[model samples]
Target: MCIVYAIDSDWGWYYFGCSTCNKKVFKVGTNVRTLNGQEITSHIWWCEVCKENVSFVSPRFKLHLVVKDDTGEARLMLLDMVASGLISESATELLNGSFDELEDPDELPEAITQIFGKTFTF
Candidate 1:
């Protein structure tokens, strides 16, 4: 069993992914258009595997944890599925609770921090 003492927040905790394909999406640029003479701007994202631009994307967990065992300590990386299961919340759900554009990604939420000081078998 390993005890999760801390989270490596320096690198952040989530990534933007294609909603349909669930693959990492890259932000290309902003798209500006005139809708009924009203200016509208939206962020554009590109998914390499999807081979297309996606207008909507989802945030998925990509957690870096600092865990300790009887032997020593080590860093562990957990992706979307596993992290979501442990936290009992989807990355999108967590992001929705905060302003993603304004908030620091490194600053974790209570749901994530609660895992600290807990021991689990990996």
Candidate 2:
């Protein structure tokens, strides 16, 4: 994972070439709250060295790459606490689809595990 620090408070974001191949990339600020609703600010940095996305928040927080292969696919992920309020390793389910526009922080599918898994980790 690419670990980077916030360089400026004006813009908690950094724009640079992805280390993968000097591709123009950026690391944006992500204010991720913990399981307890504690705001754990961090950034999802596009690794210049590893060429991968990494977290720059509390090392105690547990974050995993959430990949969506479905249509309208965006580089979305599941960010949550490691072990505190919810079980780890779960997937976010579609609350309603095939007709209406989807919103963030949807519900969980059968056999739900973590709260963070559903984008409501904060």
Candidate 3:
């Protein structure tokens, strides 16, 4: 067991996961389209491994934290369910809007910071 001494918010604390396969979704490029002789461009989420465009995706936590016991300290990566439980909120809810609103990944939320000094069985 160990205590979460600090959270490594400098890296980022979450991700947007594919709703279907629960895999990470990435935006590769801008998709351009023509309607009524007008052009429009939009960003989209695609799972390369899944080989499909995902219409729906939700945020999932992917946090790296600093934990320590009496002996020493170590870095830990918490993903998905585990991370969600720690914050008692879904990653999507935490985001509150499109991921584009996040100027910096390191600028996370108070819920994540609140985990500091908490103990986990790990």
Specify the highest-TM-score model's number.
1
Q: Given candidate 1, what's the lDDT at residue 62?
A: 85
Cα deviation in Å at residue 38, candidate 1? Answer: 7.6
On residues 27-110, what C-alpha lDDT tens digit does candidate 2 reach at each position?
Answer: 555557686867665556565566677553121112233323323323322223322233433222222212122232232232
Candidate 1, residue 25: Cα displacement in angstroms equals: 0.7
Per-residue lDDT of model 1, residues 15-106, tens digit only: 88888898989988887899999998887899999899887888888889999998999999998888887896787787784324536766
- The best-first sequence of candidates by lDDT reads 1, 3, 2
Clashing pairs in 2: 2-54, 19-48
In model 2, what lDDT does residue 20 have?
44
On the 0 to 100 scale, the lDDT of residue 77 in model 3 is 97
lDDT of 3 by residue, 1-122 (tens): 99998778776787778888899999766678999999976667899768987767788889898999999999999998888778867778888856564787667688787888889988
Cα RMSDs, all models: 2.5, 18.9, 3.3
Q: Can you tell me which runs of candidate 2 are displaced by over 4 Å? A: 1-25, 56-122
Look at candidate 2 and tell me the lDDT of residue 15. 24
Candidate 3, superposed: residue stretches over 4 Å from native: 29-43
> Which residue pairs in candidate 1 have backbone atoms (N, alpha carbon, C) closer than 3 angstroms, thus clashing?
none
